[model samples]
Target: MSTSLVVGGSGRTGRRVVERLLAAGRPVAVLSRRPRPAAGVRTIVGDLDDPATWPAALADVDGVVVCVGPPHDAAGAETVVHRGVAALAAAAAERDLRVVLVSQIYVTRPQAHPAMAHVTEARARGEQALRASGADPAVVRPGWLTDEPATGVRLEQGDTGWPTALAALTPDAVAGSL
Candidate 1:
C-alpha cells in the first residue's frame, strides 16, 4: 500500500484530506506540532519551521499534501510559510515524492484585505519555493472555505474574478480533489 503524509493534518482542510485518503485505503500519516490520534492514521509531532524533525515523517511516503497556514503574526510569514514550505519541498524532492500544496485564492493579487496581505505574500513566496524545489508539485488554490456542503464546484487555471455566489468551498470538496 502507498503511504502519504499530510502536513498540518490536524487543521480543518488537512484533516479532511487525511479522512479522504484513509477512506480510499491509502495508509496515511500526519505531521503536526501536537499529536492527533485517529484510528487508522499515524501521527508525527514536529515543527514545520525546523527541517531536522522531518525525516522520519517523510520516510516511505509516496506523496505529500501540504495544507499549512502561516503564523498569526505577519512578520513570521517568511519563517512559517515560505521557509517551511521550502523545507518540505526539498525533502520531498530528494525522495522523489509528489506534492500537492493547498493554497488560498487571490494570493497573487496585487492587493488583499489589509489583515491578510502578509499571508497572501507568504503563500505566493511558498508557491515560488515549491516550483524551485525541482519537485514538480501541484498547487491548488481554493476560495474562501465554509462549513457548508459542496455544490457546483468548478476548476480554473490562473487567477480569475472571485465568484459572487457560493464563494465558499467545502473542505470535503478540496480533499476529494487532492
Candidate 2:
C-alpha cells in the first residue's frame, strides 16, 4: 500500500488532502499541532520547529506532502519554512522518500514587499533544499487561496494571484495529485 505523510495536514489544504487519501484507502499520516478527528487517519502532533517528536511518521513513507507555513510573527517565516523544511528534506532523504511541497507563487513574482521578502526568499530556499535532498521533489506553487466554495476547476499556468492559485486546488484535487 502507498503511504503518505502530510505535514500541516489539518490546515486548509492539508485537511482536504488527508480526507482524500483516507477515502482512497491509502495509509495517511498527518503532522499537525492541532488535534483534529480523522477517524481512520493517523495524526502526528508536532510543530515544524520540532519535528523530531514524530520521527515514526516520517519513516518508510512513499511520499511526503509539506504544506507547513510560518507564523505571521517576524523571524518565524524563515525558521518555519526555510529552516524547518531544510531539516525535513534531510530526514526524508535519510528515509528515501519523495517529497511534495505546497508553495506560494510569490517566489516568481517581479516585486517583493519589504515585509514579506524573507518569506518569499525562504520559500525559494526550501524548494532548492528539497530538490537537492536526493529525493524526487514536486513543487506546487499556488496563487492566492480561498476557503470559499469552488465555482469550477481550472488549472492554468501563469501569474495567477497566490491566493487565487491556492484556490484553484481543492483538498480533493491535491489528494488526487498525491
Candidate 3:
C-alpha cells in the first residue's frame, strides 16, 4: 500500500494499526474527531459520518481501514455506522481501493443485549453495506480486544461463547492483521 487512511485512528486498535503501517514504510493518514499526538501520520480532524470530510481524507489514499466506534445513541449509531460505512464503501468501490473494517464480535448477536442492541445492529448494517457494495472488504470481528500482547488467531464460524476474555492487538498482531 502507498498511503492508507485509518478512520478512528486514534483509538487503541487504530493506533496500533497506524504504527504497524508506518513501520512497514507505508504512509498513513488518520481521519478522526479528536486530535492525537502522532508524529509521522497525518491526522485529519473530521467525523466519519460527515460526507464532506471524506473528500480530503481519501484524496491521497490508496487503502482504507474502518475502525470507527459507534455512538451510544441509536440515531447516532445508525448514522455513523450504517451511513458512514455505506459512504465509505461507495467511495472505496469508486476508487477501487480495498477496505479493512474492524468490527466487534457482539455484532453477531445484536439482540443478545437489549441495551446496546442499536450499536450492534448499526455495525452489522455497515458490514452488510460493505458486502453489498462489491468493495471486497476484509472485516475482522474481534472479541474483547485489549492493548496487551497478542497470542494468536483461530478462525471460527458464527462463534457464540468463545473468547470470554480480552485478546490483545499488539503492533505485531496489528501488522499481521493488516
My TM-score estimates for the predictions, one after another, are 0.88, 0.79, 0.86
Clashes of 1: 0
Alpha-carbon lDDT, every model: 0.84, 0.78, 0.84
Q: In candidate 3, what residue range of length 10 has the lowest lDDT sum?
A: 159-168
Against the true structure, candidate 1 reaches a TM-score of 0.88
Off by over 4 Å in 2: 149-178
lDDT of candidate 3 over 17-129, digit per residue (tens)? 89999889999999999959688888899988888887888888989998977889999999999989999888888888888999877787777778999999999999999
lDDT (tens digit, per residue) of candidate 1 on 121-169: 8888988999999886999988767767785566777866375324545
Worst 10 residues of 2 by lDDT: 153-162
Candidate achieving the largest TM-score: 1
- Over all chains combined, what TM-score does candidate 3 have? 0.86
* Candidate 1: regions farther than 4 A off: 163-178
